[model samples]
Target: MATESFLREIGGKSVVEQIVDNVTNAIINGELKPGDKIPTENELCTSMGVGRNSVREAIKILEAYGVLTIKRAEGTFVKQGFDSKMLYPVLYGIILQKDSANQIIELRKVIDVGILQLAIDKLELESLHKAEQAMQKLEQKLAAPAVDINAIFEADTAFHMVLVAITQNALLEGICSYVDQITKKSRLKAIEKFINDKATERFLLMHRDMLRVVKEKDRAKINEVVEKHYQYWEQVTC
Candidate 1:
């Protein structure tokens, strides 16, 4: 296939950025398949009518996003894990830095509630087992004379993420990941407050009961528990 057929002359955008977009489009369009070597610098220059520096820098940008990987003897190959999502860290970081605890708690409630309803259809014992493992880890963390809030948060996040995983929705998982990332600091602060207030035991018990209701396929009860959990979380966090 001809490289010129895909790449175009750089317009208003910076030459490197344009090349990056073009190559990214190529990947999305499957013109550049996974493990396929990217066109050499000379070919990219000839195809896009850009300079060698532009092509090299463009390849570097793609590589930073996990889109392309350079080999010593070979060449740059399109990486398989090249989702646009790999670029979301900066955006999520910026948004999360500006977001408030209240806003995060509100978003958490909405996203969790929606996912819980959807999860009921495909709920299985194994899924419940995963949740139970995570919950037990949380309990163990809290039981320590000196609780590690971060460990508690990790366990809590795992339990919640496992619930969503049962639905097997990639987009949903990605969105939840962003929410989880954004809420990390807030969750830590809230957990610290909740622990000092001696509310950790009730929280852990609620989650254990949550596992029970989910295993029982009790959607109505689980929904109520989820709503109450978020509310209690907000009271502590906000």
Candidate 2:
């Protein structure tokens, strides 16, 4: 693959960044493709008219983000499929933003609504059964004489995870999982508050409402359910 035509000369302040952008653009524009070996560091330098160090740094950054992979014997190639690591950059960027707490809450509401909508359309008997089982586990955890906050939290997370899984979209599941990971601490805090405030039943009901909306295939009730679900989360986060 002669990448000389796709690679362009670089003349900019952020030469390394420009090189990175060039490679990314090439991939996006179909000049480079998944499983296709990229030009060597020296070749990239010659084609892009950049220093070797700059090209090396650009490739390293791309590799770190799961955009490219380097084999010991073979050269660097574009990664072939979805990688959870690919979302780390987005997760970190969102976490670093100013006033991110409120933003995260809003983002979660949107994601939840969207996931529910998708799950409603794609719901299968087997998946729904799995979700019901998750609900049962959550109920038992909440009903325990001496509640384990950690156990409840894990059950709560699993219930929502099953809902997202029902959609059967790997990319969506991956994105939702990472977003959930970002809010893990706040979520645990919110659950603890619920237990301490004697509102564990309310927490369980919120999840039940989610299951109800999905089972009923009630799109109109999604927003209402999602809003109610997040009340505790927003209380703790914001």
Candidate 3:
């Protein structure tokens, strides 16, 4: 069984990525349940024919993403219940890192517009308020003498996620989680390059404008701002 599933021929992916997928798929298929202990490192390497490094690296990634928990003396056990947090590392390792930032920018446009429409349909006043608060957090980060890239990204991401949350669409939120990870990774690099550029300030203002439009529930303007926002990132990131 391990030979069939875990020892499959490696495709384009690295061994660590393949191992992550194999383990994730096993969990998804119900073959490995929550709280179930996975095979030992030696057992996995022997079964999958991967080196110890690959197995160790794959297990490390899974642990970081909350997929598997390691006990000091005992072996790793599958985490109880599904966490949305688990999906992004798997996605980043397997899909997004392999793809270009341009693809992410394009996807952001489509996803954000759909998210805005759903939020508009619901017209939740509280969502607008939360988005405004998130925008303020981003503004504060941007206005600081020194830029903390992670804080800016967290604030920016929180604003978008808040908007998406208003839609009450579980599937959209999950997809956004993957996108969020990809965007944050890219943003970290981009901010390093553009630290002195005044574009950073305008970027903060762009989100502020977006929040203002959401308060007005202006569909046309919301779409317009979202389009420009993602397009700007694609250009700058490159």
Candidate 4:
């Protein structure tokens, strides 16, 4: 009574990507519910009519995306939703250029501001205190004499990551992993070129203002500061 979808017709990486797409859709659409065990590797290979290597590769990719989990002595199981961490590196690798990084940062700004606005209503007192402490540390780092750009960059990352933590969303945290890695790499490259006191001061000042904005929890202000901060990297296209 049902129409059959043929997997054999799909080609190349398309076939592999198709496998991921099909399985992903099944999980997301509830056709393959979380915790539901999927067919065995051999069964999948038989159904897909693809080589065992293809099925294995597809499974690994799915596992990276958090769409499926494979356990020893058991088969693979679908997850309710893909985890952000699983998606981050892939997402980052897919968009690593300067322009794309800028765009991703812009997107993150919007998302983070919205998240922070919502979180303000639910931010734990301890969370606020922790954020405040991070801000203080950032201030001290900025005021100190010239140090390794790596140190400065790490502090900067911690500041934003702490703000993200306030939302208490594991998915958001994971999604940030790739973006953070790329951003840090780009930042180190950019700062390495400008380690002078003047450039360092400018960087420190921007971070100081960013920390102040986050602490205020002012939606509009935070968005503006975040945008400005991310725009800092837009000039590094070379």
Q: Which structure among the candidates has the greatest lDDT? A: 2
In terms of TM-score, the best-performing candidate is: 2
Q: By TM-score, how accurate is candidate 3?
A: 0.58
RMSD of 4: 4.1
lDDT by residue (159-178, candidate 4, tens digit) is 77787787777777776655
Q: Rate the local accuracy (lDDT) of all candidates.
A: 0.76, 0.88, 0.76, 0.68
Global local distance difference test of model 4:
0.68
Clashes of 3: 0
Consecutive 10-residue window with the lowest summed lDDT within model 3: 1-10
Model 2: per-residue Cα lDDT at residue 196: 89
Using Cα atoms with residue i matched to residue i, what is each candidate's TM-score against the true structure? 0.75, 0.94, 0.58, 0.77
Model 1: per-residue lDDT, tens digit, 1-238? 3453567778989888899999988888988888888878888998778888888998888887778889988988888653546647544564666545676666667777677777777787788678778877878888988778898888888887888887877756877777788668767777887788888877887777666666776777765777777656686664
Residue pairs with colliding backbones in model 2 are: none
- Candidate 3 per-residue lDDT over residues 1-238, each given as its tens digit: 2333534555679999998988888888887889988888887888877899999999999998889999988988899965676666546654545455676677778888787777778757677777778778878887889778888778778888888888888768888977777567776666554556657766766777666666677887877788777655675667
Whole-model lDDT, candidate 2? 0.88
Off by over 4 Å in 3: 1-99, 192-194
